[model samples]
Target: MGLLKFIAVGAAIGYGINYITKKGPNGRSILDDITEDAPEWFNKAKTYATEKVEEVVQQARPNSGY
Candidate 1:
């Protein structure tokens, strides 16, 4: 039963992806827009993550008398 459920869930996800990515009369897909902007989105996420990590590290470090 669990295996069947897993397979059904996988099929549903696959169908959803296909539906979203299928181009309409305009010949453009959601996937196309996503691919085009993925790089910029990735860069923004990376910068945000780096800044968060730096903030956490700064908080973790013991401050010396300056």
Candidate 2:
């Protein structure tokens, strides 16, 4: 089955490409980034991370006392 072999090879290549793209720092995943906005949960998570970063920065500075 030449047809079956071709299908398998195509699938493997597609999966490999997807894996590399995700693992690499290529900014955005092809599927999710193109298909949808960054979800609300992600936005909320980013806000929390930013708050923590600011807190750490204030603590590190001299007499900032934030």
Candidate 3:
């Protein structure tokens, strides 16, 4: 019973992946859209983290020198 359930779930997931990867009326696959935007999000996160680390260093510098 457990094995059958697992196979059914796996098939459903595989079907979903196949469906999304097909181009819609817009002429672009769902995977293409997601991958296109990934880099922008990654760069934004990197910038935000750098700014935060700089702030922390600036705050600690004054205390240490005193």
Per-model TM-score versus the true fold: 0.70, 0.38, 0.68
| Local distance difference test, each candidate | 0.91, 0.78, 0.94
Which model scores highest in TM-score? Answer: 1
Cα misplacement distance, residue 44 of candidate 1 (Å): 0.5
Model 2 vs. true fold: TM: 0.38
- Predictions ranked by lDDT, top down? 3, 1, 2
The deviation in Å at residue 26 for candidate 1 is 3.1
Residue 1, candidate 3: Cα error in Å is 2.8
Q: Write the per-residue lDDT of candidate 3 for residues 1-66, one digit (tens) a residue.
A: 999999999999999999889998989999999899999999999999999998888888966763
Candidate 1 wrong stretches, greater than 4 Å: 1-7
Tens digit of per-residue lDDT, candidate 2, span 1-66 = 999999999999999777756834767666566456558768889999999998889879969555
Q: Flag clash pairs in model 1.
A: none
Q: Which pairs, if any, clash in model 2?
A: none
RMSD of each: 2.7, 11.3, 2.7
Ranking by TM-score: 1, 3, 2
- TM-score winner, 2 or 3: 3
Residue-level lDDT for 62 in candidate 2? 62
* Cα shift from native, residue 64, model 1 (Å): 3.1
